[model samples]
Target: MTEQFGLFDARGLQPADAAAPPLCVRESRRARRLTLRVLPPHTLELVVPHGARAADVAAFVHRHRRWIERARREIASHYSLAQDRLPTRIALRAIDQSWLVRYESEPQAPPRVRVLGDELEVRTRDASNRGADAALRAWLCDQASYHLTPWVLREADLVGRRPSRVQVRLQRTRWGSCSSSGTLSLNAALMFLAPAVVRYLLIHELCHLISLNHSQRFWDAVERFEPNYEALDRQLTEAWADIPVWAHPDARRR
Candidate 1:
């Protein structure tokens, strides 16, 4: 279940500001502790562990009030939150490709994405942008898989470590992850980043095959593979601002 809170202070009673953003509190079975997520556009999500009291949730939000405010400011700087707009052109910098996006309204036809040379035609049944967004996300995943799979394999060869499998997804909080089973999961949004940053991420994950934890040995391995891993890692974190707002998961939620 989800609940929205009004203006409140650390004590959970006094109104901090009338313009304060409403906080969405959600209970999660998998959550171990109260966590805060500032989603794109300007939505604050508070994740409460099952059985957590309302007071704890309120206090958690209050303690992170400054963080929430700063995150909102950063997001506002990076994205135009006024409306959910579709992209007229999509650029994949990692692969150095761009495509013009065109849309067609077909009330009776199911939503579909068609590739025509350097253009993507999105045919949608829904009047809202939801259908088109969904179609584009699917297409993006396919494109990521097609390009990233081989890329991962090639990097694996260079690193002398082969993953059990490689999967590309539109992950919200992670750029890439490697499971104990040697499966590498990469975020589809990597396509929006530079090739060097993407390579650093791949090396970072592939190095996990050597050491899963961020131990000194892990960093050593990462550095061995990519000498400039530190700078690249920082660039990867900042690259979130470069991703088009349409590609954000929050766009679909909106």
Candidate 2:
């Protein structure tokens, strides 16, 4: 079970400084020690192990206050708070396509998105950014499903391994995953990565059909298909910075 606590709670913990960003404390049964995470766009999460004393948790935060501030600064440097607003253009690099986004307001009507020649037209009720963002995200998922599903299928055939099903979604922490039952899941955010990087990710997941764990044999299979897997894997990790802030999983939360 997990529970969340705000900056100031009833546990007699020290109150957070007035200028400090929001802090969320979560209790985890599996955690052996307190760990801190600086989530993107400005949220701090502290994971507390079960049965931790409130005083200890407070001291932990106090001890790491400077580190927290530094991490926040790094995130701010990479992501501008102003970019949280609606996007005017989107570039799907994997497909080598760029799209212009146009917004139309319709009072009391449901949000909708349409794809024109090189543009995406979003119609939303009240013209709110939230509604438009949702519509665009839905459209993005559809686009991912349309392109990534077939791409995974073709790659599976080439690798001489097949999956029971392929799914595309807007995942936050993973590029792709394969289950023991042969279900392959791909992140919709792959659309923002380079074509070569996307192909490498697909190959990485398909290779899992041979070995679920990252054992020596699993890595051997990956190298067999992609000799430069190490470099491509590094590129995938760094590509997150290139993704539009609006498409991030935490964007809507802000």
Candidate 3:
């Protein structure tokens, strides 16, 4: 369903006081309960089960105002776009590769990107952060595709499982997913994770081929392949902060 949004208002809220951020309301049939997501750069998202009321959502946000403020402060403390500008060098420990980034601008030059042994170069007429970030992201996707695809396939083969296809894309809040059809979609951001963590993610998804849901059987399968899966699973949650802000467009916006 299309996302909807609304302004939050309540009794005793003063007009002169600071206004709350815009609320993005999403209705999900699969959502069994209302949940709040306070994302980086101060975006507030509310996921409501189908048929939830606006008043219910507003009340939920209102009750959690203090928590939201604290969460935003925590995020601000950890991240600043000024410190998150595009990097001159990026290392992917998971893939054992590093890139030396160079941005070159020329008058009337068409935007282009090239990755040659350990160097990623972007040429554009406009040398703005946005342009450079976009170019770098495209290159990262290519690298993720080239590296992640083969690694996942090889691991799947060893486990005697096969996916119909694999796709690499920039995903927020997930490492990978395997559909019932056996198609696996991996987050390109896996390139930022550690090698062991990457392998655990592949095994986690591969097990889904046997059990689409995260049931006990799935956990058993994952543990069979990677005994250290639990620790790596915990690390995945905190991995987003380790990713350079330029790689995630949302984190880049301040």
Off by over 4 Å in 1: 1-62, 66-83, 126-130
lDDT of 2 at 99: 87
Model 3 over residues 129-206: C-alpha lDDT tens digits?
346676777777888999999999999997789999999988643567777788888888889889998888889888
Cα lDDT of candidate 2 equals 0.73
RMSD to truth, every model: 8.9, 8.1, 7.6
Best to worst by lDDT, what's the order?
1, 2, 3
> Residue pairs in steric clash, candidate 2?
none
Candidate 2: worst 10 consecutive residues by lDDT? 1-10
Candidate 1's residue-wise lDDT over 1-254, tens digit each?
Answer: 22112222223422254333345444444579988776544445566775667677776766877887776566554455433678899999989999999998888888889999999999987667457877788898899999999998999999899999898988654688888888898999999999999999999889889887665897899888899987787687557657666676645434
Give TM per candidate: 0.72, 0.72, 0.72
Which pairs of residues collide in candidate 3? none
